[model samples]
Target: MTKMMKAVVKSKKAKGAELQEVPVPECGAQEVLIKVKATSICGTDVHIYAWDEWSQSRVKPPYIFGHEFSGEVVETGDLVHNIQVGDHVSAETHIVCGHCAQCMTGNAHICQETQIIGVDRDGCFAEYISLPAQNIWKNDPSLSWDRASVQEPLGNAVHTVLAGEVSGKTVAVIGCGPIGLMAVSVAKASGASRIFAFDLNDYRLNLAEKMGATDTIHSMHADPLEVVRKETNNAGVDVVCEMSGHPVAMDQGFKMVTNGGRVSILSLPVRPVEIDVTNDIVFKGVTVQGITGRKMFQTWQQTAGLLSSGQVDVDPIITHHFDLADFEKGFNLMLKGECGKVVLHP
Candidate 1:
């Protein structure tokens, strides 16, 4: 008989998922079977749970769907080397096709045939998941499961905040989601002179404060552009890290950045957002970048170093934990935006 494990499955073409028994996946020749110890909720997971427009278009039902996780390798495939059972690990969630032009040119994060683990394949919201050995990132033995699980998202924060010069510069992080909060901590750890965090949610703003944001602004209650000018003395921020997918907030980021400033955008707006290219971009000479997943192994290396050296603390950001069976409670809190990173123990 095939081994069975309890997993939260998106069994319907609608909102919500079901706790069901799924057959343990077969480990491929280049893959390793991980006994998942901890997994975390991502904004993408929320979108899928809500069955939003993006989820509706991208996800297929009846599959396990989550990506951020840490586990011990329980089994290694026949062809696998350099990875062995008992290694504590998390993975780079993007599985890229190596022959693509982007992959060949050191930009595999934007590979033409990139497939996300949770979005394009069976994910980690289960007791066991098999992943390609090439993608495994070994964790420090002393790192907590929850913290290790979050390294994937933390890599995202590291990539966005460090993409440009941040040290001794005024910076703005426009979003207080978990990743946004991580960006705040990253900016502070990176020696940014001042960090402003903007969000409409008071709960998240508070979390941002604990994450090392020099100032937290409730965007709905105050004018972000006006405040940016007042704080920077009309020069505007030197760097803007855009994590809010809202068009209005994103536009404000563009406007609040100083001439020749760098704006690295990591958020995926649900639809195309219109912005004034002539004034906010061209004339001002703003450098706009569309950030995607972590930069393969480079981001992972930075993330591990930061976590291991105590350069950044993620304890405040990981605010909730639940058992695998209690996944619904975590999702409920995520939908309300009342909590930070929610980790699920399997």
Candidate 2:
């Protein structure tokens, strides 16, 4: 008989999920089976849980849906090498075709044929998961499971904040979600002269300060563009890391970024956002980059170095924890935006 495990599954094409017993995934020839230790809720996971328009368009039901996790290798397939059973690991999540044009050019994160672990196949929400060996990221033995699980998103933060030259530059992070909070620290670690964080949530703003935001703006109460402009002597910020998918925030980021500066957007807007291309891009001479997942091994290497060297600390951002069975409580916190990163143990 096949082994079974409990997992949070999007068992239907509707809002909400079910924690059910399902057959444990089998390890493929080039894959490894992991005993999940900790997994964290991401905004993407929340979208899938709510069955929003994006989820409806992209996600198929009756599948396990979580990607950010850390685990111990319990078994490995015959073709798997280097990584052995008992290895502590987290996964990169984005599995790419090595022969794709993007992959051939060191852009595997955006490969033409990319299959995300949770979104494209079975994921680590269960007690065990089978993942391709190439996706497995060996963790530092000393890193806590909570922190290890977050490396995936943290890499997103690192890639966005470090996409351009941030050293000795002023940066404005226009969002205080988990990734934005992580960017605050990444900016600080990268030697930003000053860092400003904007968010409607006072809770997250406070958390941003702890994560090394030189200043925090409550977007609901204050105007971020006006405030950042005044604070920067009316020239505007040198770099804008737009992590909020809100159209208003995106507009504010474009408006607050100085002419000829860089803007790195990591957010996914649910709907179309209008911006004056002539003013926001063409005339201003601003460099705009649409950032996606971590930059394959480059971003992963940086993530590991930053985490292991103690240059970045994600412990403060992990605000809540729950067993997989109590996922609803965790989802409730996420829905209200009252928590930072919520970790789940299977």
Candidate 3:
């Protein structure tokens, strides 16, 4: 008889998820079965819940649908090594093909054959999940499950904020979503002399200040470009971390970046965005980089160090928690933009 567990399943081709009993996933030869302790909602999860264009194009239904989580190893497959049952762990959501060109060239995060756990396969919004052994990241025993689960998105923040030279520089983070808010702390930790955070949500802007943003701009009421320029004596910011997929935010970031400065973008715009390529890039000599997932293990290492050293604290960013059965409440908070990171216990 198959053991059954409660999970949030995208069982239909429409909006929302259903919490139901499903068979526990089995560990593969090189995988480990984890007893999920805690999980968090991400922007990606919200997209799936809403059945948006991206989700319609990418997500196939009748699958479990969460990726950010921390758990304890309850079982290991025949070929698994080094990791034992009882190990506390989190996972790298991007599962990459080792033989791909990007993987061979130290850019596996953008590998041609990469599949995400929640999007491409069964995921961890359940009582248990089976994941590849190589994707498991052992957690510090003292780390709370909520914080441990967030390391995945934090890696995205670290990769974007630290990709450019930030030490002794001024930075403008043009988004206050979870990753954008995390960028504020990452910038301060990495020695950005001054940090300006922009967002339409007052809740998130206030949280950004707590995360070490030197200044916060409520984009709905104020002009971020003008404010950032005036704040920097009209020189503009030395770096721009574009974390909002909104076209306006993208334009604001490009407009506020200093000539010859760097712009690192981690956001995924829903549609084409108009920008003056000649003025924003060619003439200004601005360096633009499109950032994706964490750099295989490199960004993970940096994320761990930042957390362990107390340099970047995510405590304030995690504003809500719920049990697996009450997942809708968490999703409602997410839809309202009233929450930061919402953690769920299975």
Candidate 4:
């Protein structure tokens, strides 16, 4: 195996990711080395490239930053089990402390001691990445590497869509980014009666429609709440999946959910927003769930099942592709909303 690998490294405070040669990561005693086949740029990566407040505060430089990916196992540790070299796979990005209180209570997804692969450690935007063997997930050969790499975000969509019963329920996804668009597909596959998508980007709104949204609202030109209310007889949607972390969008999400409905918040609001808690949650009887990462292995299995069954088709969301050398261009496209899920091959 080569001792060095090509990777995109954020070596210092910068405005773009730099393509650099870095040493290939080796497997730990309980980890595995994966030969990455494909990886996708995420919103967090965009933040990292821009050196935004969140990125500056959380991400240290000289680290590789990407979490959504899939690859083949090239090496395994002594204590690893049930995995073989050449097996197609994707692993959970969150490396949770198995001894944490949350983990002991069957809520590893919220382990306070969690360290994300790409965010807190080296990620897969390179030729190879090493991860805890227990974090690895075997993939069905029928799944494409590009699609497999997306399971990380796709699992987030699944977690939101399935937090409540979507079967035959009208759903509205606020913020039609990649994850919101994925939620539209998941809601439809899970038997939603209708799916309404809201987004500021026309390109993303169009992609949402293609991904099975029954209606698309270009929030830049329309009042999303008005449109969704009209569509749902002004009763609001049965479920609201908020993927855009914009405060205004989050406010609209609360207003768009029907009385007694559930609002699954998958977006992270950067600041505290004013809201009438009594009116929004108490009076409306809204159940708000603050979503984190994937539900560890459970979400992964369900996401894989959805992919393997061909129920959630996400091909429409992959609008651009590039080799590792053009990562800046890829991130720029994402920032401009010119692409959906951009795939990068190393």
Candidate 5:
């Protein structure tokens, strides 16, 4: 009899998720099967559960959804090398086609034929998940699974925070969501002199404070640009890391940036956002970088070093944890903004 594993399955056009027994996936020639240890609820997961427009447009139904995770390899395919069974690991969720123009030019992170694990295919919201061995990143056994699970998002933070010059600079993170919150730690650990975190939610703003944000601005009462100007002594922040995806916040990030400053945007704005391109970029000479997935192994190396060195701690950000069976509860917690990073154990 074939081995079966419990999985969080989303039926076609399904509204929510369900736990079911499914066949453990067999490995492909260059694949490795990982025993999932921990997974995190991402904003993308929330979008999938809600079946929003992006989900409808991109995600085909009858697919299991989850991506941010860490695990231990339990098996490997014949062609798999470098990764061995029982190796502790985390994975880059972006599966890029190596032959694409972007890949051939050494920019594989944005390969035109990228297949996202949780979105484009089945993912790690199960007992086991198979991934191409090239995407696997071995985690040091010294790190806990919860910390390991964070590497994916941490990579995003690393990519954004390190996109341009940040050392000895003042940085304003325009959102305090999980990734935005993670950016605070990344900025602080990367030698930013002062880190300002802005958010509507006091809860997330508070978490940002603990994550190394020197100043927290509640965007409800005061204009973030005013606060940033005042805080920076009439000058704006040296760098603005925009993660809110909100049009207004994006504007504020530009307004709060000093002339010639760098603005790294990781936010995925649904509708087209209007920017004062002529004034913000052309006139001010500001450098606006659109940050996407991690810079492949480059971001992973920085994230792992940060985690391994204990320079940036995520233990405080992980405010809640739940078993895989309690995914709903975890999802609800994330919905209410009741916590920072929430983990699920399978």
Candidate 6:
């Protein structure tokens, strides 16, 4: 009989998930089976749990659904050489085809043939997960699982903040989600002159402050654009990291970026958003970057260095922890925006 493992399964085409015992995934010839040690709730996971429009269209029910995680390799396929059983690890959730044009060009992170773990297939929301060997990332054995599990999202923050020059430049992180909060810390560590964090949630804004935000703007209480203008002497911020996904906030980010500055967007907006192209892009000479996953492994190196060197401490941002069985509690806090990064221990 196949070994059974506990997993949070999206068993229906509805607004929640179920805890069930599922068969452990088999390690393929070029794959590894990891024993999940820690996992975290992502905004995408929340969407799947809530069965949002994106989830409805992209996710298939009766499957496991989580991606951000750290684990130990429990088994390795016959063809796997880089990783060995007993190695502590995490994975790049994206399984990209090696022969794709983007992959061949060293831009595999944006490979058109990318298949995400949680969204496109079985994910890490279980005790064990089988992953492609190429996607495995070795972790420092001494690193805490909570911190290790969050590296994926932190890489997003790093990639966005480091997309352009940040030293001595002012940055506005538009959105106070976990990734947004991490962006604030990354900006501070990268020597950004000022870091303005914007969000409607006071809870998240407070977390941003703890994460080293120079100023936290509760959009519900203040006009974000006006505040940015007032604080910057009407010149505007030098860089805007858009993680809000809200149309209004995204527009504000464009409007508040100084001419010739950069706007790096990491959030995925649910619907199409209209913008003043001439004012926001053309005449302003602003550079707009659509940031996706971490730069294949370059961003990973930066993120690991920052975390290991104490330049960027994520302890303050990871506000909660729960056993894997209590995942619902974690999701509830995430849904309410009342917590920072929530980690789950298996």
Full-model lDDT for every candidate: 0.94, 0.93, 0.93, 0.89, 0.89, 0.93
Best by lDDT: 1
What TM-scores do the predictions have?
A: 0.99, 0.99, 0.98, 0.97, 0.97, 0.98
Cα deviation of 203 in candidate 2 (Å)? 0.5
Tens-place lDDT per residue, model 5, 41-159, is 88778778877666778888786789999999989999987999999999999999899899998899999999999899998889899999999999999899999998898899999
Q: Can you tell me which runs of candidate 6 are displaced by over 4 Å?
A: none
Query: How far does residue 188 in candidate 5 sit from its true spot (Å)?
Result: 0.6
Give lDDT tens digits, candidate 2, residues 160-263. 99999999999999989999999999999999999999999999999999999999999979888779878999999999999989998999898989999999
- The runs of at least 3 residues in candidate 4 whose Cα sits more than 4 Å from the true structure, single-residue gaps closed, are none
Model 3 residue runs over 4 Å out of place are none
List model 6 lDDT by residue over 1-346, tens digit each.
9999999999999998988999999999999999999999999999999998878988888899999999999899999988988998988888898898999999999999999989999998899999999898899999998899999999999999999999999999999999999999999999999999999898888899999998998898999989999999999999999998999999999999999999999998888888899989999999999998898899889999999999999999899999889999999999999899999887
Per-candidate Cα RMSD to the true structure, in Å, reads 0.8, 0.8, 0.9, 1.3, 1.3, 0.9
lDDT of 3 by residue, 1-346 (tens): 9999999999999999999999999889999999999999998899899988888989899999999999999999999988999999999999999988888999889999999989999888999999889999999879988899999999999999989789999999998999999999999999999999999899999999999999999987888877987899999999999988899889888888999999999987867899888898889899999998899899999999999999999999999999999999999999899999999999
Per-residue lDDT of candidate 4, residues 1-346 (tens digit)? 5599899998898677778998898788898999999999988888888888778888888889889888999999998878988899998888888998899998999999999887889998899999988888899887889899899999999999998888989998998889889999999999999998888888898899899988888888888888877888889999999898898888888888899999998886666777678888899989989888888788988998898899998799988889988888899898898889999999
| Per-residue lDDT value at 43 in model 4 | 85
Please give the clash total of every predicted structure, in order.
0, 0, 0, 0, 0, 0
Q: Which 10-residue window of candidate 5 scores lowest in summed lDDT?
A: 8-17
User: How well does candidate 5 score on lDDT at residue 302?
Assistant: 93
Model 1 has an lDDT value of 0.94
Once fitted onto the true fold, the runs of candidate 2 whose alpha carbons sit more than 4 angstroms away are none
